[model samples]
Structure formats: structure tokens, C-alpha cells
Target: MNTPTFRNWQSVQSEVLRRIHAREWPPGELIPNEADLAIEFGCARSTVNRALRSLAESGLLDRRRKAGTRVAAQPVAKATIDIAVIRHEVEEHGAKYGYQLITRRIAVPPVSVSGTMKTRAQDKLLHVRALHLADDAAYAVEDRWINTAIVPDAAAEPFDVLSANEWLIEHAPYTHGDISFSAVQADQGDAEVLGVAPLSALFAIDRVTWDNAAAVTKVRLLFLPGYKLRTQL
Candidate 1:
């Protein structure tokens, strides 16, 4: 048997992945350092580092400072979701996109939002309500609260032309976010915005984002009936 020589980071990563899958590097087993891996694979140490870092990000490997890399004791695969402009979403569905700004104002967020975003109850947030349309029909209703303390520019911008959903995505960048999906029954507000009967079942997405320690925004999007979400792991 001969050790294989790898020329690129991807090939090195592949071999390491194979070894892990074969249990040669069992769960919780510390793997060789980059220097050793580079020598064995006939590749540069940077290549090995790149490969291991990639694995670490994907939850297949655990890398700690001053603690050598090891296979994750309990690996988890995360699904990747993209936050796209509502316009793009409708256009991709082969329909002409339209946007209507329902309301925009500065108001104190509900306790539910303030508690989740960790903002002060007395703090005012920019509340934006908008309707996204596919062709001429309603697609989704966006209810959002923007933390002006973190994203001050959002307070001044008139969202009548460009939706706050698209505006924040372009201007305010965040470090990390969380999203959840569910089926929710429409209330009077949702019924009016989506043009659906009250209590109609709709797909909903609730999202919150932060920039380091400061919360940036919290949004709830209620999509029309029969909306299907797709993601990749």
C-alpha cells in the first residue's frame, strides 16, 4: 500500500473525510497535526490546514486553540439557507415581482420582540410592514422591527421604493442569525395583507440577526398558502 500525494486543499480534504468515514479517525480521536499530515500527504502544511478548517466549519472536526484537532464526538449537519430579495424570489418563480409598502413608523416593539432581541422595552424600533407580490397576487407579508441603535440608517430611509427586507440585506451586514419556520393561522392583519381569509394556514418564517453583541433586526414573514421552502445541507 502507498500513501497518496495530494496537490490541492480539496483533494486533501477528501482523503481526510474518507478516513473519518472509515473510522480510521474515530469519533473523539485526535488527528495528526498539520505538519504530520503535510508530510504524509506530500502536500504543504497550508493545504492540510485548509482541509481541516473546512471540516471544522462543517462540524465534522473540532479545532480548538492549543488543543489539537479531533473528529467531532457528535457531528451535526446544518442546512444552508439564503436570504434573497423578495423581488428575486418572485422573479425566479416566473412571475413579475411587485412591492407595496404598507406602513413604516417608529414604535416600541412588543415585549416578545424586545425580549428576544435583547433590546430595552422602552427602546423604539423602526417597524416596517410590506407586501410582496408575485405577478399581481400577494406572495408574502413582511412584518419587521429594525433596531436603530444598531442600524441607525434604517430610521431615515423611505422604504416605499425598496423594501426594508432588501435594503437591510444590502446595507446592514450581520455576524450571525437564526431562522425558524412554521405553519401559522392568519389573523385580521395577515388576512388583509395577503388577501386570504382569516385563520387561513400560511407558511411563516421568523428570523433574528445580530452584529456581534448588538441585535440588528427581527422579522416575521407570512407567506401565502401553499408556499414551499427549499434548502440544502
Candidate 2:
């Protein structure tokens, strides 16, 4: 018999982060409702909710009633660390910046996602993936999800020409959100995207944004190995 995939808050967080870094859900973009995420993750809605809540607490996501969730244009900096913009980070390192779009789609989110977004599971959401490069070398991968109900214009935006990251930062409006950081082993998909060996260590940043109580978007950014972040103690 085949074993069922074990779903948990950590897995959910990781998946969500993947999408964010891919720009499937761009900064300031609305994300799928929680119920959709829960269904997609094959986990309890409560579990998805818990994961989102943790991201929010970590300054990675913005959540609100009626408005739903969204990605933050400027992810809040952790008190212990200063948040750096991806493009700026690359330029500061004296590397030429590059970006590539990989995929875009609209699909029904898992129940867990819907539960977190406080929407029905049957709702469809916009998904996007992309890559960030520095001096022609893979710098990071982005995966994201967007809520059409809140940002209908997102459906027409051309992600192939301009990154969702730049688009949302210019178009979507938001008031508050959160950010977080961590380390994770590259999985098969991440390995392929980043051109690294599977199980390679990588840095991760998860963020969520909001326009008042309404959520704007959620995303995760995965950096290539050796990337360093500094903060004051």
C-alpha cells in the first residue's frame, strides 16, 4: 500500500514559501483563502491556519477579515535583523541582476489554504513561479499564490514580461505584514531550480503583507547556499 503524504505546518510553510520565492504570489498580491491551502496541502484546515499564524507572527504574511491574505511589498524586518531587498542585495554584492519567469496558472487551492484565507476551498487562485539570478548565477527561487477575488487585475497582468514582484510592489496597496528567516535543505525541485544538489543547505525568507485587516499576499524566497544575512544583537 502507498503511504499517505504526511502534512504538517512546517510542510505547509515550506510549500507556501516556495511559491512566494517563485513569485507565484507577488509582493502585495492577494493569496488564496485558507481553505484552499488546506485542501492543497492535504492537511487539516486548522493545521494550515496554525502555519499561517506562525508566518504572520514571524512577519512573513498579512491577514485580515474580508480582505483575505496578501504578500508584503516591504516585508517587515525582524527586530534582530535588517531586511534587504533582493535586487538591492544583488547589486550591493556587485553582481548583475537577472530574473526569469517559469510558470503561471490558476487552480483551486487546498482546503488548508482556503481555511487560512478564510474562504471556501473551491475557489481558484493565481499561482506563479520564477527565478532570481545574480551575475547569471541562480540567486533565489520564488513561488507564490494570489487571490483573484481581491485583485482581479492580477489575472490580466503579464508576469512573463515583468515580474510579479515588481508589478505587485507598484500596483497593490498594503498597510502592514510580517517577515521571517530560516534554513532548509534543497529538495529535488529546489535543486533543479537553483542548480544545486539535493539536500544542499539553503536560506529561506517567508513574508506576508496586508492592507489594513485585509490580506494582500504571501510569499517565500529561497536563496542559494552561502548567502549571508546580518543583524545587530
Candidate 3:
């Protein structure tokens, strides 16, 4: 059989998604290895790797180092937490969005934060705290630290009109990152900012984004009580 020429990784990804959706590759079925797919698609192994990686990240495939790749029997509903912008999130709910810049300063981050970002303890980072509102009500509070060395423009941007969260989405495009979700009781500071009672349970999301291998920023977002995060598989 003649191999089909794929223009790019996206083409390969689309074809893979199409097959999975059409059940040509059924759930729990082992898919061809990257070498085989590359040859079939007339593309390089790296191209196939990128396509598969994207699908795995989206919760469509399960990839293991030694076990190879397989379609997920029960695909997880992955949230778009990696690239979600606060402003867009609020506006998407049909609510009038508002932003407040609470604080901005250059300071040494905590030891834990420094360790997570892999920055030296002596390095000064740009710290920014802000609140996002929906229809004039408290929505979420953002505590963020930016690496000035990696994002010099962050220092000059006042973060008054636009939030650092939205700004970074526009300016700093990351290649890879990590995100975690948890529930926490609102502390004094979180309560005051989110207009919730102290010790009230709230949803928290911690994210760290990187440009290639260099850390760009780390942020913790605490949402008001009763906030719901939903995604479809």
C-alpha cells in the first residue's frame, strides 16, 4: 500500500482522532507504535510522537514507556486548565467580568515556591496578587510569581488594566506545564479577597508554566465557594 503524505503533526493528529472517534481504533485497543505509524503516514517518528502526545494529554490515549500506547477504555474528561484565562472564563458564563489589581512587588519568593520554579533563593521575582469578579461578585483570587529573567516584559506591564493571568496567556506562550486541583479551607487572606467566611471550603488550582525548559510563572488560584468546574470527555 502507498503511504499517505501528511503535511504536519496536526494532520496526523486529526487522522488519529478521526479513527478513534469512528471506532476504527476501538477503546482499549493497542495502537501501532510510533515507528509503524510514521511509516504508514509517510512522516518522521517525531511527528507521530507529537501527535500521540497531544492525544494522550487530551485524555484520549494512554501511553506507557514500555507498554506502548492504547486507546483509553474510559477516556477521562480533561479540563482545559492548562490554557484557561480568567477573563475568558467569566465572560463565557455570560457574566460581566471585572478585574482588580490587589498588589504588585518585587520580592524573594518562599523557599517552596523557589524550589518548585527551580530558581535560586536569592533571586527576586515579580509578585502579583489580583481578584477576578463576575457580575460584581467575588469569583477568584490569584497569587502569582513571575520569573523576571524569563519574562522581562512582566516587570514593565503594570497589571492594572489587564491581569497577569491574561497577559501571560497573550505574551508568554508555554511549551509545557503542570496543573493540580484541590480543595482547601479559606484562610484569612483568601476569605477577605473572595468575600467568603474564614475556613470555608474552596476550590484551588495550582499551575506552573514553562517556556521550553525555563520557568515562566507559578500561580495559585482560589475560587469562591460553590464554584463548579465542568468538562466533557
Candidate 4:
């Protein structure tokens, strides 16, 4: 084989992820040890270890004290979302779409949000709630809080037309963020907006977006039932 080329730790990690995705190292299959991988990639053993260590941290691999490394049975794959226009998502389903602004006001964020943001108790936030519709029927309910301290311009913009999800993504460039997801029983308000039975299971996604230095926004999305989030390796 041609000499394996990797210039840095990042390159080595990318190659390892690529191999795992390709099933060269299939789930539950033991990967080559550090020394073997180092020799194969023409890198130091430490370089290979660093790459494997990172994959383990990201839930892609399982490492044991003496049993060595194996592919995780359920790897946490990364997802990429292009800040799609709501109009696009609605149209793709062959429906006319619109947005209704329920409430928009400046207030202190809720305790849950405040805890995630680690902001002072009185820090101002632009709290907004809106219903996204597909041909006059509600499709999703977006409850969002924008850190006014991070994006002061959000206060002046009119969200009566554009969706908050689409707006912030376009205006703010974020370096990184954290997202968590779970299934939750819809509450009264969510049931009303999503046209579902109270206590019905709904897909809930909570996200924190940041602009390198500070958090820009924290949002919770309550999706209608039957919403499926699918991704390939």
C-alpha cells in the first residue's frame, strides 16, 4: 500500500473516523492496537493514541484497560443541519407555509435557560414564541430565547415574517454548540400548537448556540409526532 499520510492529530482522527464509518472497523470489532496503527500510518504511537482517545471521548469507540479498543455498538454520529428556510421545509412537503408570532418580549430567561447560559439573574433576553404552519396547520412550535447581550440587533429585527430559527442562523456565525434530544410527553400548550393529544410523545431537542466567546442563544424545539431525525454513517 502507498505510505499512509497524516500531518497532524486532526488528520489521524479524521482517517480513523472515516474507517469506522466505512465499517473497516465494524461495530464490536477490535481495532488494531496503537503500535500496529502507528506502524501502518507511519506515525508515532502517541499520535495514533491521541486519535483513538478522541474517538473514544466522542462515543465512537469503546476502550478498555486491557481488552483494547473496539468500535462502539451504537456510535454517536455527528449531524449537520444547513439552516434551511422554513419555506423550503414546508414546500418540500407540498404545503403552503406561514409563521405566526405568538409573543415577543424582553424579559429575564427562565431558570432552566439561565442555568444553561450561566448569566446573571437580571440579564435581559429576547423571549419569542412562534408557530410554524404547513398549509394553515401547525407543524412545529419554536420557543427560543436570544441572549440580548450577545446579539443586541435581534431586539430590533422584526420576526413577524421571518422565523427566529432561520434568522439567527443567518445573522450569527457560531463556532460551536451543544445539542441534546429526548422524547417528552407534550404539555397543554405544546399539544394545542402541534395538534396532538396531551401527554403524547413528542421529539424534544434543546440546543445551545455560541459565537466562540459567549453563548448567543438557547432554544428548545418541540416537534410534532412522527417527526423522524435520520442520518447515515
Q: How many residue pairs clash in model 2?
A: 67
Regions of candidate 2 where Cα sits further than 4 Å from its true position: 1-80
lDDT of 4 by residue, 52-86 (tens): 99889878999998999999998777665544556
List TM-scores for all candidates, in order: 0.74, 0.62, 0.70, 0.67
Query: Model 1: clashing residue pairs?
Result: none
**lDDT of each residue in 1-233, candidate 2, tens digit only:** 23234378888787777777788888888998889877766789898888888877877788888898887767775556656556777898899989898889998767765665555678788888899899999999987777767778899986886777778877888788677789999999989999999999999997767777655666778989998887552
The TM-score between candidate 2 and the true structure equals 0.62
Error of 1 at 145 (Å): 2.5
**What is the TM-score ranking, best to worst?**
1, 3, 4, 2
lDDT of 3 by residue, 1-233 (tens): 86579979999999999899999999999999999999999999999999999999888999999999999999776555324688888998899999999999999999999999999999999999999999999999999999989988889999999999989988886899888889999999989988888999999999999888878999999999898888654
Q: What's the CA RMSD for each of the models?
A: 3.7, 20.9, 6.6, 6.1
- Candidate 3: what lDDT? 0.92
What's model 4's lDDT at 37?
85
- Candidate with top TM-score is 1
Model 2 root mean square deviation, Cα atoms: 20.9
